[model samples]
Target: MKGMIVSRPTEGDLPVSLDDLGAAARERWGAWVTERHTSVVPNAVLTLEVEPPGEPEFTVEVMRGPRSINLDGTPVQNYATAAWLRSLMPADAPRVIVFDDAWSMHADLTYGCTAEGLRAGTVDHSVPGWDAGDPDLY
Candidate 1:
């Protein structure tokens, strides 16, 4: 019944502005970042780590939503993880699940649903940037 949410920036997408990012975080996590700017790390990439109480560790990334782009390229914006989470959660479930490890410099941001939830249809979402082909991918 517990999990984590992780996020990072994506390439070739609408450069997620600080304001948009803060709004998205507030909507999703109910918390706001006090400061915002381009990450000092090169490549314009960032990882937001999250750890929920008594839940499996997981992560999510901030990429251009699918609707925000076309095969030929164009400007568009769409719901990303929230929609995916809604699809996985039961319609009747109350209280949104969130994580506390919001910012970590060296943390892994890979979302993971509990085994029981996966079996019970409580959490069913595909993880991106994860390759099951590798022996240690999980």
Candidate 2:
């Protein structure tokens, strides 16, 4: 089902430096990234909208520290797709939450990004229509 994916840094993971993030964005996304915004006063937040050369565009909201990095993109079709999306963030991110309201059960699907690789799990609650898996919602 279509959903929103959010990845966050664990206690052990270091906060990504703004410079490193900027370089990483350029390296990983290059000119494919159409827009970039950063807030540094109250808090450091970097937002990027990436539209690959062709189809399938997405938006990423990155916050400093342990705050969550919300990623709303094309619905993952397979584990590889999920992994690719996860790769967009720092490798230290330990888990990702996938929320899909279309599911009659819980809407959140949690995935652990461990050294052993991604592990899927169930969430206790639901966030109905969180993103409705819509890119335009960004």
| TM-score of each prediction | 0.28, 0.49
Q: Report the C-alpha lDDT of model 2 over 1-138, residue by residue, as the tens digit.
A: 444434332243323454565676678778987445564424437766777766677766565662545455654432333444455555554444444444322222223333123333333335556446644232
Residue lDDT tens for model 1, 1-138 = 222332323222332353555455556655322223334434433333334345333333332331121111110111224333433433443323322232111122223433333234322224443434534223
- What local distance difference test score does each model get? 0.31, 0.48
Worst 10 residues of 2 by lDDT: 103-112
| Candidate 1 off by > 4 Å | 1-12, 31-42, 61-138
Cα deviation at 112, candidate 1, in Å, is 22
lDDT of model number 2: 0.48
Return model 2's CA RMSD, one decimal: 8.9
Instruction: Assess candidate 1 and give its TM-score to the true structure.
Output: 0.28
Which ten residues in a row are the worst by lDDT in model 1?
A: 69-78
Alpha-carbon RMSD, candidate 1: 13.7
Total residue pair clashes for candidate 2:
0
